[model samples]
Target: MSTPAPHAAPLVLVTGASGYIGGRLVPALLDAGFRVRAMARHADRLQDRPWRDRVEVVEADVQDPASLEAALDGVDVAYYLIHAMGGGRSFADRDRQGARSFADASARAGVGRIVYLGGIHPDGEELSTHMASRKEVGDILLAGAVPAVVLRAAVILGSGSASFEIMRHLAERLPVMIAPQWLRNRIQPIAVRDVLHYLVGAARLDGAPNRTFDVGGPDVLTFAELLQAYARAAGLPQRRILTVPVLTPRLASHWIGLVTPVPTGIARPLVESLIHESVAAEADLRALIPAPEGGLTSVDRAIELALARVRELDVATAWHSATPAGAPSSPLPEDPEWSGGIVRGDERQRPVDASPETLWAVLEGIGGRRGWYSWRLGWISRGLMDRLVGGPGLRRGRRHPDKLAVGDALDWWRVERLERGRLLRLRAEMRVPGQAWLELGVQEADDGGSILHQRAIYHPHGLLGDLYWWAVWPFHEIVFGGMQRNIARAAEAAPPDSRRAVNTDTDTDTDTEETA
Candidate 1:
């Protein structure tokens, strides 16, 4: 495929390519006929995307100023989507640093414009750490040397999205929920599809507006109403929600952690963010992005889409880790930390007729939305066990559908290495008595086919870790082997021409039912 002319569809650069919004944004841009260059700290995180080969993936970290120059070079419009919400308490600082550095870099690269998705809130209301950091990022980007466009929204509802999952898990699991009083606070929830539309439309916007716009759906509902609406759509009975005035955000966060798949770090900020009204400040965004044909989504309709993705497992492609994004910017560690410890593992390889790119896509998108490709019930069971023990769990899904980059959280794994068409490795994050790693790869075979390799490495911490490994070894044959074989078959079965087309005509997420 050839690049679009500068005047046609600007060579769009999406930062945070391994993130939820960034992951979904890429396909939207491609379908809209824009040539895209996606930047993430680790390009390997993006390897499994169906459209993996459709766009250029560059390994660059916004926190590292020196790396931005090359990634920003020749970019017509840069989407400043990187934020530190997943980065924890110090996220504000990290977000500020990243945004300032990115803005400065975009200016230096002679980039024509920048677009950022920011947070929305009522004025005069003290914001939470998450909202404050999000707003600051937008502030920095808006002041960029080049013209910038900031689109702000509240409670983005999508299948795998953090905000959506919070209410979703709560509604599904609790027949009666004792939640924070903030659930009563009003909010304007927008569908992920509409958010993408605004973002894509921003590319074709003429001239430098260098301004901020608030965007949201037509309906304004409180958090409780949103939850109730979701319950109705999912066919669940009306849930009883008892709002306790005494539960602070911190308590609510811990309560959420115990009940939902969301971790404490992510839940706290999210809960705190709900303390105030978040209706869009203006309706003028319709002029710029233009409303879609049927108009904005209702909470019920958005809930259906979100729930559908959850059911289909496409939620992983649309979400990211709840852990703070403090993992070193490197995607895959070249070597283990190297402590004197005993290790055990499973290793195997197979060959496939598809191209290396096809196989790599299969390996890249193994977890999160697409699932393990086999024995998913076991995977979900393990993830639940991990969450019970305070591990990262499967809930912290990958950021993008097909992209795997360094630091991205997979179900109980963190993308450790992505060598493009050659290798993809994951470090296990689930609570185990030992440190575990799973590696998958594809390379050219002599006869023109490709070799696929799979391995599970575990370094036992003690007798318990040793026992844990032994207990799980028998299941690896069924889980790991099945996953490998399924991936090969899926890759081979896929049409070479299937990925060439980007379906931007309508935005949708079709996921399977998530394991409880």
Candidate 2:
């Protein structure tokens, strides 16, 4: 493949662009005045991102050499943020293979630099499978022909980070608990903002050698102390934690899986990594790349900022953004009728005594603290069931109270499509036997009012999926029917001024009323 024409700014390729770090890094690189090309296995996943229009998006998989080579073409720097943490027992081997492919592709493309984010591990000690895999990937990149910068960090504290979410839920849910012995292991956590700072700076380095750099925040604390700090930041009472020796990482992972929204597959590796101290061994990188403005974020301040972002409904990217619920090739509801397999749906339309704008406002603000505008008990029961089965459940919540962007998480649903004042389509993230979506729309009626349309679409996998659909088919009335009625009622009752204030822009709107 031929290289694309160069821009005034250096072109940067960000692999895993839909992932937490990659998603956040793209905008940061753009803000730093670099032309960015975002690569993902499914380019459609990047379509909904707010920065989708600004960056060049290419569908590429690291495991595919040709795809990697094509993606790295015309790239000055490439950020390798891909990982296979939850891909079962062969994850490490897969990681190694992908890293090797990426390295070879970068060298062939003549990419100047490759920046990789890896976990921090104690030197000369046996590391957990997770940490070992990270180190191996870093080693592969550094040993390659291209100059690479490997940044090793531990416990990235952010609103939607896996580590932060695990800590947050544990601190909030269990005031008194029997914890694992590793809770007392010392760790040097860094804020996601600082990690981004160093990442952006690494791209501009004049002649940095290919080496691994340990990056961490100022404070060093044990996991127990970190939990206490989290409790303090969240205004919770001091937690009573009793450490016991019998609880192994495997056992603790199951316990954490039940307590937090993080699944056992991803939690096991994290729990194992916590068994070792992860304090930075050196600060050599500081001499090359300067610290962020002010200084390295303190632990307390990091926790506070993360909590504030959650409360204010301003989380930029979530841990699950990288792994969207359904398959990318799955046919959308809007696709041609003859496109996909056995599809089932529950469709409802109601003429409302409200304007299209009023109905749209109610539709936009359906999830999060506003509730589902339907059977409250049923929604809660279903969310709980989903949680028990290791799904996101309803805890993910919406990013904003009044307005939603396309990729925003609304409870167990992801905002797949959004048309301001017209339609909102949500894809189910809750664990189910089949792929599903919920769509809400507003249309002007002939009688100077509005018409509300609601749909629940599901695409079954096999006999099990078909059976699952029929089993829940009986409750459609109580769930879907009630939702339709309640949403129309909410639109009719909304204040006139409140209906006019619905803004679809991603900016925080101070004028909008805080919906409950």
Candidate 3:
């Protein structure tokens, strides 16, 4: 039997167009031959993307129903991807109100259908505040005049996803962790790529409306198992993880904030939601779409893809530095606190069983060969833009493998100074509104381990530099954090080449003593 393709692509209006999932979805829609009208609070935020010109950018908030009439005017389908993840304390109430307002306006606009992505909740189990609120929003959307297609998914594993970031941070920061009881909860994590497929598949779905599909990856594993797998793929040591019943969600959220860049405002609700085992109950989605292509990606392959993408971002910006590496080349002076200026510094020490030489190998291997931590396409496109503005674009790779010297070019950075197994500095060559530097220093532990210090510094020119610095902060967080963890993981996974040197020294000492 042959199925006919749909006549014309619908003009799809996507809310939450500036978000992580929304960012990916809008482009996918465009590539699939749909005419997209994206709505965001600010259009300037959408300017960096390549598709900015291809689609109509309407500046409107979902909460403001009056503003949505224009946005929804000519749209055949609407996708509601907005959530109040960063809203403090009462985000659930805010999310519900916003969804209701949007639903009312969308229905009045005579939209044919509404597609929403919600969280997966077990049938009879108690749902967390986040999951419950997600359900509430879906219910409200379905009550409208238009048909709503709801797709519920578990933890979405991707580069910029909140849940993925939280887990990545915990795995990197804590070597021996005392986790909450929720850590043992089973979860079916779907890749962001897979989730996009289901969302896009629903756009012209034949006859399903006002129906909910519980979607997840094929594999179901406990949170502990996921964490360990992430650690292994990232090259982190096999950590001793213990789950204690004492730590409440609130306390765990605070702990997460301390260890990772996730703020309390966002992590709290997410942590509260961690109590549920969010595996899919129905397998019907597989029947709708074929099996293998729509299934979950293996844990190792997913992490590798993510890491490689991030590295590509960094290398694409080669010769186009963000912050200068190391101390100032001239006598301008350096900012002490992390102000809006370019260079930023953060320090944390972990007890590891590795030598300084092993750690340096990981550092030198960063640029050229190593991938950026997250959002490779975003990095490459931006890097190309930077290069087009007469900045360096992707030509600079390191001079040698596993070796660096002062003033050596590692991508856009010139190695300012190199102390073997101790310190490394890079100076920026990119034409920014200000200057930048990236400095990494190490201290050998008394127990034959090492302390890793990674810092990024930028001296902004004025207002524009400050704006540029803050604008890229989210990306900086993802890229820098991933780099630090990769270094630690690489060091732990490989044995130091100097161990043989140490053994030879011991043998010589014994021979000299016997001769005497």
**Model 1 misplaced regions, further than 4 Å:** 1-8, 313-316, 321-324, 328-390, 394-410, 415-424, 431-435, 439-516
Worst 10 residues of 2 by lDDT: 507-516
- Tens digits of per-residue lDDT, candidate 3, 243-311, equal 999999878876775555344545777787778888888878777766445356866666665555543
Q: Rank candidates by lDDT, best first.
A: 2, 1, 3
Per-structure clash totals for the candidates? 24, 0, 20
Cα deviation of 254 in candidate 3 (Å)? 0.3
Candidate scoring better on TM-score of 1 and 3? 1
Q: Model 1 Cα displacement at 256 (Å)?
A: 1.7
* Model 3 lDDT at residue 48: 46
| lDDT of predicted model 3 | 0.67
Give the candidate number with the greatest lDDT: 2
Residue 362, candidate 1: alpha-carbon lDDT:
68
Question: What's the residue-level lDDT of 279 in candidate 3?
Answer: 84
List model 1 lDDT by residue over 1-516, tens digit each: 234454765688999877788888999999999889999877766776667899988989888999998898888889988766546567788889988999898888888889999878777777887888888788888776889999998899887777887888888889998877878989999999999999998888978898899999889989999989988999999999998899898788877766766766667777877888889889776886668879888788888987877666455454453224765332222346554547687889888887777777667666655667767677767766766655557665555556666656766677776676787778776667767788888778888778998887877778998888889888988888887777777777877623321222111122322421
Q: RMSD to the native, candidate 2?
A: 4.6
